[model samples]
Target: MSSISDHPLRYKLANELHARPFPSMKAPCSAAYVAIKQPEDAVSRDRAQDLAHLTALLDRHGAPHPQPGATHYYGQIGKYWLKWEQHTEFVTYTAFSDGVVARPFDPAEFDVFPSDWLENAPGQRMTSILLNIVPRPAEDVAVTGSLDEWFVSESLAASEVLDGAAIMAGDFRIDLNGHLRFAVFAGAQTGARRIGRIVQRLCEIETYKTMSMLGFARVRALQPGLNELDTKLTGLMGTMSDERASAEETLHDLLSISAELETLSARSSFRFGATGAYEALVDQRIAALREERFQGRQQFGEFMMRRYAPAMRTVHSAEARLEAMSSRSIRASNLLRTRVDVERSAQNQTLLESMDKRSDLQLRLQRTVEGLSVVAISYYAVSLVGYLLYPLTQATGMSKGMLTALATVPVVLLVWWLVRRLRKSVE
Candidate 1:
C-alpha cells in the first residue's frame, strides 16, 4: 500500500505562516516607515507599479530584486534593511538602520529613502513615521525630559509595556518633517526580537489609526448631503397619507430617494468595512503591548479612548443612519404603492357596478320591445284567420263576427307560446 500524498498547496500554504516575519533589531536603532496608497480606487491599483518602485529602490544599492509578483520582501539595502509589504489597499516600506544618530528623532533619519525615490513613489503617502529606539534611562527625569523636548505634552502618550520590558511614547501628531514620531525605550533585558516586535507594533498602531480616520473624514463630508436627504424623505413621508398629494407622485419620489440611499450604501460599503478592520487592528496592536501607566502619564489605549473612539463612533452612527433611512424609504414606497393599487381597485369596482346597472336597464327595454311585437303580430294573425274562416261561415251558416272572436283567442295563445320558445332558444 502507498502512503497518502500531500495536497498541492500544502507547502505553499504552510510557508505563508512564516512570511513577513517580525524584524530582529536591538536598541539604539531607528526605522523609517511609510505607507503609500492611491488617492482613489486603491484596492484595484496595479501591483506591478508597486513592485517596480520597490525594484527601483533595490537597484540603487545593487540588491537582488524580489521574486516576480511577490507580495512581501525583506533584504539589506546599503546601510539599512528594507521590509516591503503589499496589502489590499496600500503598500508599506519600513527601513531599519543601526546607524549612529546625533540627536533624538532626527529628521535626517528619514533620509534613508532618496528624495527622488520618494517623489516617484507609486502612490501618495498615507502616513510616514520615524521611529527611534534606545535603552531606557536609569533616571525618571531623563525619560520625561526627552518626551517633553520632543513631543507635545497635551497629546503625548507614554506607557510601560510588556511588564516593563520597554516604555513607548508618541504624541500621534505630524511633525515639521511631515512624519509622525514615536520613541521606544527598551529595558536591558529586552532581546533584539522583542525590541523589533515593539517597534513593529507601534508602526501598526499608527498606520491603522490613520487609515481608520479616513472613514471619519468621509462621514464629515457626507453629513450635509445626508441631512438634506433626510429632510426630503421626512417631507415626502408626511405627504404619504395626505389627500392632496397624488399617491403615484409620492411613490415615485420615495423610489428615487430609496435608489439614492442604495447608491450611497454601495459606495460607502468598502470604506466602512475597511475602517472597522483597521480600527480593530489598531486596538489589537495596542493591546498586544499590555500597556501600564508611566509617570502618571496617559497610556496609548487611554489616549485612543479619549481622542479616537469618538470618530469611529461617528462612522458607525452614520452607517446606521444611512441604513435606517434606506429602510424607511423602502417602507414608505411600499405603502404608497399599495394605496395606489387599492384606489385603482376601487375605481374598477365602481365601473363594474355602473356596467351592471346599464345591462339591467337594457335587458328590461329588450323585453318590453319583445312584448309589443308579440301583441302586434297577434292582431294581424286574427284578421287573417277571420278572412279564411268567412268562407267557412258561408258553408256552415255561421256569422263572421263569431269566427273572428273564436280565432282571436287561439291566435293570441299560439303567439305567446311561440314567443316564450324563441326567447328560451336565444338565451
Candidate 2:
C-alpha cells in the first residue's frame, strides 16, 4: 500500500479506475469479456453504432428517448426494459420484461422474422437468453396480431439459437418453453446481474496495475537514500587519494577515513533493507486484495452458473432447497410459539388450584370460630338458668348453690361434646 503512494504510475492508475461509475455512456462496456475479446476494436465506435440503430428503430415507432453515452439500452415497450450490450465475442442482448417474460419468438409467423440474424456462428450453441434477443411490442396487438406472422417455428428452434435479433423487426412472442425457466421473465435483472460480474473483472485489472506501480516506486524511492550513503563513502575515498607528506598524521587520517567508509557501507545496506521491506509490504497488500477478488469471482461464477445453465436443472434445484429450508424454519417457529402458549396456560391453571386451596382453608377456619362462639354463648345461658332454679330448689328443701353449680357444669360439658360431634359430621 505504501509503495502504491511512493510510485507515481501506480497511484495514477488506481485513481483512474476508482474515479467513476458509468464514466462515458457512449463508451464500450468495461467488462473484461468484451474488452479482452477485441482489444484492437474501438470501444466507443462499435457501441455507438449499435445504439444508433436501436435508437433509430425505436424513434421510428415513437418510443422513449435514449440517453447519451448509455453503455446499455433499456426501453419500456411491454412493461420491460430491453437490454443490449457490446461484449467481447459478440453483442449480448437480453430482455428484462415482466417477472415471467418470454423469449422473443412467434410460433404462427415465419417470413416477417429473419432466421440468419439469430443463428449461431458454426459449432457453438446458444445456451442462455443472453445470446438471444427479447422483443417488447408497443401494444398488445403488435404481439398477438401482425407480429405472429414472423419466423417459422421450425427455423429458430431448429437453428443453433446463437446471436440473433428478434425475428420480428421489434415484436416478439412469449416462449412457451420458457415457462419452466424463470429467466424467461423479461427485465434488466438478468443483464444487470451479468454486467455486475464484468465490472468486478475490471477492478482486478486495476488492482494488478496498482501492484506493478508499487514495485517500481519502492526501488525509485530508495535511490536518494543510497545516494546519500555514497556521498559519505566518496569523501573517505577522496582523503585516501590525497598525497600529504606526514607519517603519524597521515596514518591516523587513513584509519579514521577507513572507519567512516565502513559506517557508510553499513548505512547503504540498511537503505537496501528498507526498500526490500517496503516491497514485501506492497506484495502482502496485493495478496490480500487478490484474495478478496477471488471471493468475488467465486460469487460471480455461481451467479452465471445459476443464470445461464440449463434453465430447469440448476436454478430449480437451488429454488427448491431455498424454499424447503424457509418452510422448515417457519414451521419450527410456529411450534415454539404453540409450546410457549401451552406452558402459560398450564401455569395459570396451577395458580388457580393454589388459590382454591387457600379459599377452602379460610372457609374451614370461619366455621370452627362460629362453633366456638355458639358453645361459649350456650354455657353462659345455661349458667343463668341454673342460677334461677337454685333459688326455687332451696324453697323445696334442697342444697340450692351446690345443685345449681353441678347442673351448670354438666350442661357446659354436653355443649362442648355436641360441638365436637357436629364438626366431625361436617368433615
Give one clash count per candidate, in the order shown. 0, 15
lDDT of 1 at 204: 90
Give candidates' CA RMSD values in order.
Answer: 3.2, 33.6
Q: Per-residue lDDT tens digits of candidate 2, residues 74-185? A: 5553333344544323343333322221333322122211234233222122222111223334453543343224433222111100122111111112245321011011
Worst 10 residues of 1 by lDDT: 37-46
Return the top candidate by TM-score.
1
Lowest lDDT 10-residue stretch of candidate 2: 26-35
Off by over 4 Å in 2: 1-330, 349-364, 380-392, 395-404
lDDT of each: 0.92, 0.38
TM-score of 2: 0.26
What TM-score quantifies how close candidate 1 is to the native fold?
0.89
Candidate 1 local accuracy as lDDT?
0.92
- Top-lDDT candidate index: 1
The sequence of per-residue lDDT tens digits that candidate 1 reaches over residues 236-272 is: 9999869988998888888999999999999998889
